[model samples]
Target: MAGFPAPQTPRGFGSGKTGMRTRTTRFGRTVVALMLREMASRYGRSPGGYVWAVMEPLGMILLLSIGFSLVMRSPALGNSFLLFYATGFLPFNLYQRLANTVGTSLPFSRNLLTYPAVSWFDAISARFVLNTMTQLLVSYVLMVGILVVIDSPVVLSFGPILFAFACAALLGLGVGLVNAVLFGLVPVWQPIYRILNRPLFLASGIILIYESMPPLAQDILWWNPLLHITGRAHEGFFAMYTPQYVVNAYPIGWGLVLTALGLLLLRRHHARILQNS
Candidate 1:
């Protein structure tokens, strides 16, 4: 016993804390590796790479600004159509893109799932983290550019703006988790989900303010959690506007419920999904 290394604890038979730490480190590395792989595969191959990410939204905002400026004297909330649409479009776009990516996490990483180290949650998290950070950076750059170029008289309220981002991310993650399960389990669900989602752009207060809508439309659109998110976003950008229709609990409640449901379903069915894949 003097010279021999104290009976080396067999790998994975170590103390509880050591085991936990090993697992944690492993999970973190797995997630990071997956993130890097995605970045290379998704954006690295494209021409102009990440520039397209910012330009796509910027182009859309510019087109909207030019077209709207022709028909209307000013935006509904502010003098600059660029700022108004950017505020509404950016957060909504973040949710849409994030949800779409998160929804496909399982199938996208199906091949890797065969490995013991790669779990379904890890796949979802990698996509979520990568896309979320990319979108946030794009938003920041565009927002700063708009403020610099447009000279819009606007007050920046970080509280509501951050709240909007949080809600968008939560909703995206929650709905995405559910979609990932459904999309993987039921192939037909993808098309139907797309059809249902198409109306969200118009309905989410991106093109129309909540107050300006008819009473009947207001009553119905109020149920859309995204409408509340856009309203909250507008509140942060426009000092004069305060949307009473936005209920803080509505979006948060939907996000929490859907996230819980999605996680439960994924846990129950992930093995079957992997097998089928």
Candidate 2:
């Protein structure tokens, strides 16, 4: 046994190869394995499975639309409160869920990191791909169902809608990268971070449009990339609300900076994380 290869950690997963092709193959398989594991543990094992995804957000949207419609007699945006809230709520929810999923991915999969086949990159990448894909699908199906059922009088722009979803993914992934390291290193920061960010939904432009907000609030929230994403989504769906506030490059830039910094930290501290955990 000692003279043998000492039991490799599974070749397809990771073999510590130096060539680009080998490294790519290794990482690709690792990601797939992680994704499959994630799917099984999350959606596959649950009873409601994927339906739960669409239902939770759908319920909130209906309650808000109906409850507020009774009070204000109409939504702040379009005639259909469902469309207005869905347009904003879905994207914000996507960003929020992606951030939370990515943020805690390290701690959630810490045990997997002990294997030579699994890298820190693999862990985060798998979570990002899985969650982003899941959220995008949920948003699309839910939005289409609402639009078809209600048949609202709105001209949907495909380009802006796609762009908004992409931005939400990037912004969430960026924040998640940073939070992954923070939560892993500190452990105690999770709840504090949650508490601090608890008001994010209120500030993420879910309940109101950007144009309807106070000028000072607008200036302050202008820096929040999520606001830009939600604003862009509404711009895509609502024909009347063509928001001029979104600076196309801001979210991308912030996302890049944060993701780069977070990757750098993980590249440095990943080994220590596994050791400690």
Candidate 3:
């Protein structure tokens, strides 16, 4: 006891209330910092920071419209195919981008785990949030551009659009999370993703309506949740379109199931999987 001195408090540990506040602030800062780091690494070096986010979907729309318009004899989708395609493409692209990117996030961020805040979920969530926001912004820009160029009487409806986006994000989140974990576990999952994502373009209601199909085919495609989401999204844009466009409880249920399973799997095996990698 002759020469001992009191220990000083660490930077972030203080009185209980102050410590809690400090932790909360640190957590928020970490998330935002990670998000910005990701956004910059992914898109900042390009000439425009976020314009490519809008351009990507817009370019796809233009190429698809032009190619389809040339091949098809008549515009079967009426005078508003631009609006129609925009509605479908936006959500579908969002789902695809999120799923594809998230699948690689775990493996990609393995090194970043040296930092305490950079958990697997944090990495996945950052990518998901960025892609989802970009999709929404791109969707709005595409809608305005369509209205201007095509002169289609674009109807604005928030309810179904919101629902459509929510479902799409949930669906994408579930699929992406599961896929991310799987890819981390099994190398073969990569090739499988490549093959599986290809069919969604045709299988989803992006290019064709289920109603346009024969009764038997329509019945079959109704099993796909992407179709239901896209169909419901279109209904929001076109008043003539109805909720009955397609029906599939599978996507909604499957989405929840997959997301829960993903969380469980990640919680149990994330550290081991990454450590082994």
Candidate 4:
């Protein structure tokens, strides 16, 4: 028998591309893989998994619309109440889901973090991507359903809706990253997060516009960036909708600032935290 050639080691095996590809490619691949993993784990096997994501929000909208229209006798939101609610509620849900999921991401992925290829950002990105996609799908389904049910004149304006969702995602991701880092630092942060996030549902412009409020109240609500996003989203869906609310540059600015800070913190401390855990 011919002597077997020495086993050839794979190129880049010890050169940082063995398990992980090159940095840029690896980062993209990791993010995408993590996103897929999350989708599969969370919503793949069950038939209702993905459908429920859309249905849950739609149900909330229907219930709220009926309650407001029949029981509360609230003024009509717009020609298409379901559409209006979809525009506002979907983005708000995205923000809330992203923030909540990301807040617990690090701890949630502690096991995966043992693998060198898996980074903290990968975990956070996975959750964010999953939540973002789910919310967008839900929004689209609700929008179409509303048009069919209510027969409202739906304008397919891409600009405002795109901007609104972008802003919402950015804001949510920034807050989530910060919260995740903090939670990784302090395990007790979960209870505090729950308390803080619960109040946000009411404060965020889910059911009403900020402009409809009194001056003082409007001034106060103006500080919330979600209000601006909801207003802009509604503007996209309904012709009559306009954002009269004053939103300072702070919330948007804070999103950028926090994201940067969170990334820096994650880069520096994430590995250590993983090792400690």
Candidate 5:
């Protein structure tokens, strides 16, 4: 009420319209401010901050390539193990980074949420945009670096890669939305959620090829939407690799459902959550 404008409406049952519009406008402004603050504090504080994103995956790809090259002769998809793992890990890393940060955005920005202008939605949205853009930029750098280094014909298809990255991010956002509220309200769910999701990276198609897995394994992992997105990313990166088991609808469907449900729940319980926080 303090930061928000006092909306003057007729003494009638149509107050909902004005109230909703007021909150929406305020939320938009609050999210923008939060984003800028995060950008400055999170990235601008240090000279090497932004480069960490690129450095993280670059180190992983190099280590994997060097270590695995000795044991395994060739990669499952491409000749360059660096390219193969980069395609798989970059998207998964994006999802992981986004989900973890977005899920905890409220608590991390709890001080800001105390202000009337900043709401839970604004905090989460700010983190989502900042992290997503950073991850996308990091992915582009790593992908381009790999292509340039590889001594082979590069066939780039933007559509599928974009779709796969989009799905991965969507699913991350949806899951983060649900987890954010859960952890923010309960606190105990934080440890439990981490324990449950400890094996997520391993299962996200980074270490193993999806199509090469056994039938039962595929059936079990089919429920994981990330598996589909990760596989599709590889398909996009390597021109010749066609993974038959990757279903586009799987991740999209789950992402939509999770996101919608999380938003509905959050909208209904936002005030209670703020009070608890």
Candidate 6:
């Protein structure tokens, strides 16, 4: 009896911190597996894969730079049209693509969701993390390329830029969660959402600066969270230009409110929605 070893406790069934760690580990593994699967299906099967991701955005930036160069001597904020448009377009694109991916996360992973190990949160998280990383990488590359190629004397303020990116990502996630429920249940909301989303680029200060817009336009667009995001981005990239109308609380509020509503709805109706699907 003196030499007998102490009995060992079970791994995952333990109380308090052990159980919490076990749950967190399981969720992390599930999310990672889903992310791997998504990368394989979405990019590995395609011909060009991730290359297309960079090309598409780069092409848009180039076209915008070329078109605007012909019309005007310089861009609104900076002499380099590429930098101005990249700052606006990249963050907006990140939000747009993230929202689309997260919106379809449940439907896309429907079969997998049936398994006990997988969950709706895991599915959404996989899409959100993978896509967000991809977009951020693309943005970094394109922005660096523009800065190097143009060799412009630009000073970047990371505070507003990081804030802008955070707002965009959270806003995308928030809207996507709500859309996920609506798209899964209503079925007709998908097309309607797309129709409504088309004008965001034009209205979001991507092609046009906010201060240049007429007062009426500014007043109307002030409510758009994307506009605030873009304004923050411009403030980061263009040191001289600061937008007085950009309110940090407005976009943050939209993100938090929409996310809360979406999570609440999902918690309440996810089972029925999944079953119906």
- Tens digits of per-residue lDDT, candidate 6, 1-277, equal 9799899887655686877988999999999999989989988977599999899999999999999999999899888899999999999999999889988888899999999999898998999999999999999999999999999688999999999999999999999999989988898999999999999999999999999999999989999999999999999999999989899999999999988988888878777778767
Give candidate 2's whole-model lDDT. Answer: 0.84
Query: Which candidate wins on TM-score?
Result: 6
TM-score of 1: 0.93
Ten residues in a row with the worst lDDT in model 5?
268-277
Q: Which digits, one per residue and each the tens of the lDDT, describe model 5 over residues 1-277?
A: 6999897866855777879988888878888888889878877877687787578789988998888889999998879899988888888888888878988786688788777777777888999998899899989988888888997886777777998899989988999888877876888988998898879877878878887778898888878888888788888878997878877888999889988888887888766666666
Selected candidate, larger lDDT, 2 vs 4: 2
lDDT of 1 at 40: 90
Off by over 4 Å in 4: 1-21, 72-76, 246-251, 275-277
Estimate TM-scores for all models: 0.93, 0.89, 0.86, 0.85, 0.87, 0.93
Deviation from truth (RMSD, Å), model 2: 7.3
The C-alpha lDDT values of all candidates are: 0.91, 0.84, 0.78, 0.77, 0.84, 0.92
* Pairs of residues clashing in candidate 3: none
List where candidate 2 sits over 4 angstroms from the true fold: 1-18, 45-47
What would the per-residue lDDT of candidate 2 be over residues 39-152, giving only the tens digit for each residue?
Answer: 988888775888997898899999988888888877777788888889888878877888899887776778888788898899999999999898888888988899898875
What is the C-alpha lDDT profile of model 3 across 1-277, one tens digit per residue?
Answer: 7599887887655577787888787767666776787788878867586887778788888887888878785443556556667888888887888787776767666778778867777777777777788777777788877879887566767777877777888888888888877887887887988897898898888888878778897878888888888877887877766767655465678779978988899888888768656
RMSD of 6: 3.1
Which residue runs does candidate 5 get wrong by more than 4 Å?
A: 1-28, 275-277
Error of 3 at 189 (Å): 0.8
